[model samples]
Target chain A: SAVISQKPSRDICQRGTSLTIQCQVDSQVTMMFWYRQQPGQSLTLIATANQGSEATYESGFVIDKFPISRPNLTFSTLTVSNMSPEDSSIYLCSVVGTGPLAGYYNEQFFGPGTRLTVL
Target chain B: SQQGEEDPQALSIQEGENATMNCSYKTSINNLQWYRQNSGRGLVHLILIRSNEREKHSGRLRVTLDTSKKSSSLLITASRAADTASYFCATQNQGGSEKLVFGKGTKLTVNP
Candidate 1:
């Protein structure tokens, strides 16, 4: 199992403001992803944080709204730009561990998550 | 393009009893996985069952996959209060992106 942590555990931002959440992994990982969980909803994949390249966003999400950067194997950042009340959700960072179980299961390990409340 | 759907949106049970959650997905998948979330926090991966495998077990957690039915089920034996959480099932498509598509999830409340 991999240990992951996120900055700004919880934050309250005004509408139109932007906030960037940082994710750090204890070990180098090849696949890192960003996800959004709205109130009373399931997790939605926002984008795939690719190292040294633009993130691969899912449908209904764009770089303009959610910009992500994976500078290295152990770190990534996601910026919520021009935030709105609808964007108020729990943002999570996830990565596939390089443990012995990796061969048996490609399960993902997630950060604690950043809870953003846009007022 | 939601791929998975979990039924019985919520469940309540007494401790020591067993709890079951079912999930169905559309399209062919390489593997199906179950995840648990406490409150609104990050999810914890519980177990994964590949398309080729019919069943898998990790401790007290049991997962079964039926590719012919495009559905899967998760069973927790002797549930405990600490097991109260939202359970979600995710599907990894046969090809393309390695992303896991999550379902709505079933909120399980194991009362002590």
Candidate 2:
């Protein structure tokens, strides 16, 4: 399985401040996805990031509020802009592992996630 | 948005007992998967059952998908204390893409 890491394991920011969460994969992958888990809620897909293209955001999630960037196959960043208390949630990024021997061939390996708290 | 709901939002059982969690989704899926997440950690993929398949097992975990009902169930047998975690069911929407839609998950606590 690919080794995935996310920066700023956690952070506390005041309202209106923006925070960028970074996700890095040890190996290059074709698709990287970002998901958000609000308190006591299910995981929601924020967007899908493909290298060298604009991210495809899901319904109820806008580019202006949650922007994403994929500079290469091994890395991506998700930024939460104009944060509010409701924006506080655990943000996670995952990648499809390469090769059949990597974990479950069809499974996604996720980062530990970045916990954000907005006051 | 989430794909569907997981029943018995929370469950508590004794070790060595069998724990079952059911998931219901809204759309056709190419495949349905079960994942386990210990508190404060990332999710770990458990098993995946394709739409064509009815049941699949991996060690202590057994998953069944009923396409007709658009529902799935995950059974963990011989549960141990370490089996305590939140179990989520995710599905790849039938559009042929691999985007996964996850359910709220069932929180299971196996006591020793």
Candidate 3:
């Protein structure tokens, strides 16, 4: 299992301001992804962060609003730009762990989410 | 639209009893995973059941998958108060390499 950590566990930001959340993994991982979970809702993948390439954003999410940085295999950052109340959600990062083994299922380990509250 | 949907939004069970939560997903999936979330914090991966495998177990957790019906279930036997948390089901969609679609999750309350 990999130990993952996020910075600024919880923050309250202004509606027009921006906040950046950082995710760091203990070991090098092949895949790192960003997800958002609104109050009482399920998780929605924001994007897949590539180590050296522009992130592949999911529909309705753009690079301008959610700029992601994958500097290395073990580190990634997600910044919520021009934030609004709707952008207030728990931002989580997950990485694929050792798997697809005997059971042929790859597991993902998530970091303690950075909760952003837009006021 | 979301891919997987969990049933019985909330459930309350007595300690030492069994708790079951079901998830239904649309579309072909390569694998289905169950995760536990404490409060609104990070999610802990519980168990994963492959598309070909019908069931898998880990400790007190048992997960069953039915590719034919696009549904999966998680059963926690003799659950305790520490087991009280939100359980989520995530699916790795077929044709989609690493994208995981997560369902709304079921809140399970185990009372002492």
The per-prediction i-RMS, to one decimal, reads: 1.1, 1.4, 0.9
List model 2 lDDT by residue over A4-55, tens digit each. 8899899999999999999998887767999999887778999999789899
* DockQ-derived CAPRI band for the predicted complex in model 1: medium
Please tell me what DockQ candidate 3 reaches: 0.82
TM-score of candidate 2 relative to the true fold: 0.95
Better of 2 and 3 by lDDT: 3
Higher TM-score: candidate 1 or 2? 1
Which predicted model would earn the best DockQ?
3
Compute the lDDT for candidate 2: 0.89
RMSD of 2: 1.5
Q: Candidate 1 regions off by >4 Å? A: A99-103
Candidate 2, which CAPRI tier?
medium
TM-score, chain B, predicted structure 3: 0.97
* Candidate 2 wrongly placed segments (more than 4 Å): A100-105
Tens digits of per-residue lDDT, candidate 1, B60-112, equal 99999999999999999999999999999998898866788899999999999
Task: Note the B-chain TM-score for every model.
Answer: 0.97, 0.98, 0.97
